[model samples]
Target: MRRRAIPLLVAAVALAAAALTAPAATADEGAAPAATATDAAAPAAGADDRHRPRLYTPAANPEAYSQALDLARAGLYRDAAGILAMVRTPQAVWFGDQSPAEVEREARQVVRDAAGATVVFSLYNVPGRDCSGYSGGGANTTAEYQAWIDAVARGIGRSEAIVILETDSLALIPSDCGQDDAQGTKTAARYAEVNYAIDRLEPLKGTKVYLDTGHAAWHGPASITPRLVKGGIAKATGFFTNVSNYQTDSANSWFGKLVSACVAYVGEGGDAAQCPHQSWPREQADAWIAANVRTPSYQWKHFVTDSSRNGQGPWVPPPGKYTDPQDWCNPPNRGLGARPTLNTGDPLHDARLWIKISGESDGLCLRGTPGPEDPERGMVDPKAGDWFREQALELVRLANPPILPGS
Candidate 1:
């Protein structure tokens, strides 16, 4: 979900939505939400892309389910509810960005209507989630962060939700986001809090959780292993690498391979002779395995990529004189990648998902304009749905995904 605070000048959409959305029910007896046709449309499995995994989502997030239903109705259900649990609207965010009381009331109603949905959640306000922009914003104190996580866990209650935990926390550990202020203590607490969140969310029988592994561009194989450890990767079912960001399948696949290799390398210890990245002697491979990759702590998950907005891959830099790729934040010409679902090829790459929706802009850049603005198109932001549609169709062709036997 987009996280920008809509200025109070309030677009008519916000006002109209607030004023006219169907009134939700009270705690005692809620109005049942209308269900979509049981037989929704879904693309036939790709001939070779048979690794179609499904992401179980809990109904705590009506918006996510609705989005999934939309995809199903459009014959894209295979890619819709495939990714685990997708977040609806976090109460903290609704309260902070739009309204407090309204969000509180609406949240309960949403939860009620989303009874069987399997949810995937994100805790955006961890103390040092993102170092700077695009994905920045977190609590100041660890205690506050914990309180926020506790609330989320409670909101999840017994629902079958897949939580994404916090994004970018690992990458930002050594960052200048005031982590050095209290030195190791603050850093340690960040992990502690994440661990706390995992423990709280995972106990529910239906919940399957994963922690964040920054994008392929952000952290190298060896670098991310220890970071994932600190972020409590051992405790979670697995860790997700690329979320709500763009990276070609080729690049993410290579990155995931290296990270998995490195995790194995480090777990065994830094014995270069044992772990070989190149064509090495059999002795070296065995040695590497002995020295690394042998952790009894946990067996992590296959990775997942955000096919969203990557129809045109990462924003390529122009010639030698690069003005801006516009890809760093949100570029206007972008579109939704793959809809969230569990069918990526690599056993390590779990899902090809729309981690970030296409039409939503990433707010303002370090400069002024919203990152997705396109001056040539006279499109200054992510409001119009055209860019998203164009990009989505382009990606569908680019992927040349094998359509099901019968659409």
Candidate 2:
């Protein structure tokens, strides 16, 4: 029965067909080029003038954008925008393995393209990234990683941007992931590298740096807060949660608040060991916050969450289905979460529930299988960073806010 279910799911995805890759008129053909930094630097057209977060549409994703235009031209306006919307919002552009010169040039280009609007840049070249897992490959040494981060900082050059530092750098540590001391000592070096990044990037005139904390599902507030503090959350604007993972906004938000409160509590001479965990009831948590967290929400460390692919929340593996579920990997039936916005009502929650991880990319799933193909899906998923058309279409189809005509 389980084997039969896999084929059906794959068939449904297959229906998207060439539409996923169809070419259409250029974006400039129907739409004007995005405003330049000079134009964006000018005074507001209205009293409510503010710098809009710039969505850096990658040239690599022309197929997705072109397909959306085709859909719109075919009068499928909602469908078209649903697909195009991902590109229209701010998503993190990762910098890894590139030289100081190369990363700086690329970073400047993105900031210049934003024309002074806030753009998200993800720094992902930690010393031992991904714990030597499928997404492995980072800087070979601490000195190399620091130099890379310094280059990234120089690239921004006081431009307005939010730097999402090192996803999984803190969440997956050497102790847990069995990372080697190939360079004599990597675990300690990882923490030092993150701190170095914060030191370099946080002082930039217009930058906001947020370190990554795995997700609500993985690390509890109690366990993750100390890690954040040690990783230099005090110097950063705050920390980020749920980067590239599927966890609900509610869960992520709550978890973030708890972490924020913990940071504040510890900062004010309180103990993190005594702070309330996410497992506690809402009333109890609130009471704990009121009693212990004396600082105002604004004064506390704020956090942002990645709501990229969590509309249906985390995947629940079928009972006894596989030896290793790898639930965090590419799971079936996941949907897009909230659109990016700066106006989160909660003060502790920062602007932009961003697509920290691009939805177009595949999460290589092994699922305890010995072979290359995922046993559950019965297919070899695309390597990380490769476009996954089936998953992209699924995200559009299952968007929670319902990617509609006006929405």
Candidate 3:
């Protein structure tokens, strides 16, 4: 599912106005966002890659920038600066539900905005997306989806772009969500659709397409590896995890390494079931990788992780509070995670991204309750892709790296 906002001009104008009214820097304020001590000290995973692309920061959501102005007017300069800093950070621009012509035009405009920097694109609108859940709705047919993807490719022309092919397309297939037929027609179509997308987008000289592998918490590396292979991982740059989910960076990185190793092992005639998963002891898993997986780091499938809202890690529900906790849906107290960076300092890991637009609602979360209001928050959450002001404020206040410099 993808979050959206009002038209581009309105958001641009609102963000500009808010930027003008934001308080001038004080002695305590720093010029740019300051990385936490933990981040500054973390080992470089892929520091050898001296040519990693620069990331592009797209325009902010209208409501979010407007909220910054509102806070500034209310004499909360720290919060206002935090919000401004957050929106100014680099993030993805999603494309979906638009006609091929519309998408092509919009994609071209985004490339133009980026100039020469690399832009991250979250392409939703796959048919049967979300299995008709809260953020459902996609192209009506397979042909329509192919046409849409083709348009996106044409829009990029030859510019640099990292296409996060489709979130949840592999992790939660039609069969997993019970949306498949007895003969599995929809599931097969889903694979073909993903393959088609990879074939279409990955060939562009300036484009690198990545498949979806859910998150570290959902599917184990061994379980998702076979699916990635079937979905044409051999053709894609690699796969991404933790899109729109709250999982720790360490967890995601380990999961990615395991999955890459498993893919290589399976490719070398080993069974995916026999590979080490995230649950295995780290010492044992590392030992296994050393002994069995012989693929070079450059040859192995690289991965990107979403760090938009995992600053506080994941939320824990009170002991057996609800039948379906829906922990993934709008869990409270989640803060913003690491800032997007290509120089992640890991060989297997590519980058840490903010794939899910921070501050957007994750639909109406009931948490298995019967009330119209969310039991945890005492009010109904906004619709799936709408702006969530309360959650936005919470994210800025609790941001792990600390959105403000000295806060």
Which predicted model would earn the best TM-score? 3
Which runs in model 2 stand beyond 4 Å of their true positions? 1-60, 63-81, 180-184
- Candidate 2 lDDT, tens digit per residue, 1-407? 23654354233323332234432112211111333211112233453445443344333365565555455556565566556555544466778868888998998888877666667788878877888777788888888888888889888988887788888999888767766556536667778889999999999999999987899988887788888888998899999999888989999889998999999998898778898888899899999899888888889898888877888899999898788898887788888776665556778887545544545555678777686887767788888876666677678778775443223
* Each model's lDDT: 0.48, 0.72, 0.82
Residue-wise lDDT of candidate 3 within 273-293, one digit each (tens)? 989979999999999999998
TM-score of each: 0.63, 0.83, 0.89
Task: Give the lowest summed-lDDT range of ten residues in model 1.
Answer: 23-32
Alpha-carbon lDDT of model 1: 0.48
User: Who is ahead in TM-score, 2 or 3?
Assistant: 3
Candidate 1 root-mean-square deviation in Å: 10.6
Clashes of 3: 6
Regions of candidate 3 where Cα sits further than 4 Å from its true position: 1-52
The TM-score of predicted model 3 comes to: 0.89
Worst 10 residues of 2 by lDDT: 23-32
Supply the TM-score for candidate 2. Answer: 0.83
